[model samples]
Target: MDTLLANITYAGGAVYIFYILTAIWIIAKKNLKLLSIIFPILALLEGLFIDWRWGRIQDYGENAQIVLGALPSFIISIGLPFIGFYIHHFITQNLPKDPMIDSLIEKSKSGAFGNDDYPSIYSLLESKIFEKSSYQKAIQNVENQKELINKMIAVLTDKKDDWDWKFNMFNEYKVVFTLYGTGGSYDPDNGTITLLTNKSGGFMNYKNPANTIIHEITHMGMEYSLVRKYNLPHGLKERLVDTLVYLMFKEDLPDYRIQQMGDPKINDDLKSANDLESLNSIVSKFVNK
Candidate 1:
């Protein structure tokens, strides 16, 4: 039926418009100048073609007419997404700018996650790179082992049944992977662990990311509570995570190589399993020392 065909075409056009807008926003955020210009032009041309084709559908009922009858429909669908590109140009070319803002716009264009200079987990995991290829396959392993990984973290951290509650986690924990970065990075707010998927002589055995997941999840539990509370430096935080993980999961995760990344000064004080029982108070005692 022409009516049904028109309906389907209309829906498809709506989806295409939504997708282009989302893409334009990303291009703007990522500061891809060429793509910003190209995408909107492409979207506009495609939208016009689609509108013309839809007009060809015979007996396209009153509903289609109301939506697609006027040139305004084409403008609304194609013009909105292009706004981000214009706004980006305005900010960079016309407005007062600083080094920090410039750095954010330019450095973000790299979109590469480096181990030492890691960005937010949101940026890394939300990246399109891991959507396919070796990284995608490796991330799947992490997902499958996520439940067991969280349980291991709960036990080693001694929170067990009340782990989420104890950590004050508001969301169900998530696990994802990045092809680069530290063995793992934790986003406490999102309760996510992004593991590096380089299995070539790297820590996470890509076949099984359980050890890496447990390590980062352990960080999530402490990040807000103990790490922030003590104002522990990055080195100290890494050291503390490993200390707890090793103390609790040494046998279960024999393959896990403790990176020993943190303040060496406090090493002798945190080697005992008994230390896991009163971790917070002990950390406070040693940290203030």
Candidate 2:
């Protein structure tokens, strides 16, 4: 314990690990020039804060000072992610224009969903992929909602009328209707929203795919950037998304409701539309604790 505590590298790797991950994030975000400049300043401030805190440690218990030093590191931690998410609100992203909404919300007739790639839990329960009639009918029903769904998505987006360009880390978003899955899923890596067109909508208040599309779109908007980052419980993730959706779109989709899936505890942070705006930082606070 003493050896580890004595070595800053041993006990304070968070700031360093933060540096590497942040560099990757800045590079991936492709705003190297601006973010790179700010990062150095933030890093310098963090270093000074840590140094000052470390120096103030009592002669007998250096660990006390070390922990104090670590406290300010969180400032930089908070600063950078806030910058990233804030940029999303102001920047004009590369999402599809209207009329191109079809391109964003199109149909998938292919029965070969590479079901093996996903877990058995995500696979369809009652219907098979080869159910051509079900698949096509599902596709048409989903497409019919594309126009209204596109509008409802505005509230889920960064701007009133714009789509979340980097939502789920994918630039372009599309929905895939298949007879295989139970309800719906949004894949962040590929920007694909998969919805089960099966007649048997098993759970999560999934009466139909139209509302389910909005739900998954909500998930796509938040999944990686917020939910997974905090290692949030699945139930909490669903609840937060459901709350955001209900707060933003319950009137448009009258049947919309927050299913009893997520941790009711998270409700403390997500009661209104105002809370939705600061969701990233709010969730970020979880790890700070």
Candidate 3:
């Protein structure tokens, strides 16, 4: 019985040490400072209790020398927690920082996506407050989009679809085809459409461009329905809009191929969109009035 108890106690001590060391390593690698600090203190308590349990069990079988065997356990219990804390501090202070993550954290902390703050999609579209300067390039985009809009309106006008859709003023948009992360937001509350793109190279092919217009336009159309049917949170509503846009636009692209990859080239990188064949395939089947 005594031997069994000694073996169990020794195993427990080994496990505790393993957990402590693993936590310390993660603290160093992931730079989880708070977790690192807290875990070490818990580890120390665990170590002390384990040693105490082992000492009590061992006293019954063998007179283990106090200074050589027991003193090391006590020292580790007292010192290891502080060592973990300091290691965490050093890791946090010395770790290389990512500016993008920092920016996101800052934005999150400041309530950047709050209801009262963001601009409406219509307003953003009208203002053309994009980070671009060339009016000619933007005007070309508008002209190309106008043709697509006309085609979509024609398609829908003939079909007796359930939804009432129209261009009231041309606020259609697509996410920036760039590497930056701004393309995927749809705010239901403010009716804002935030797109991220780097449009330096050139606009997407006109044949497929119309699909992009139809995509965003579809989102706008759905927002009206969602606004009437559900009082969803702003972020969730935005995501819903993105999903709907992607689904519809996938039918409008030239080859019926969807671009699943991402790019850092701003508006130049066209995301996966529906091809013309798919749109024609789906729309032709719809019975008209």
lDDT per residue as tens, model 1, 17-132: 34434443454464456555655565555445544554444442321111111111221222333456345433211121234323433444566423432233223322322233
Model 1 CA deviation exceeding 4 Å by range:
1-136, 143-147, 153-171, 180-182, 198-207
CA RMSD, predictions in order = 17.9, 23.9, 28.7
Q: Which 10-residue window in model 1 sums to the lowest lDDT?
A: 63-72
lDDT of 2 at 243: 88
lDDT for position 164 in model 1: 26
State candidate 1's TM-score. Answer: 0.49
Sequence-dependent TM-score of model 3: 0.30
Whole-structure CA lDDT of model 3: 0.34
Tell me the lDDT of model 3 at 240.
41
The lDDT of each candidate is 0.48, 0.48, 0.34
| Runs of candidate 3 exceeding 4 Å displacement | 1-132, 157-181, 184-195, 199-208, 227-251, 255-289
Which pairs clash inside model 1?
235-262
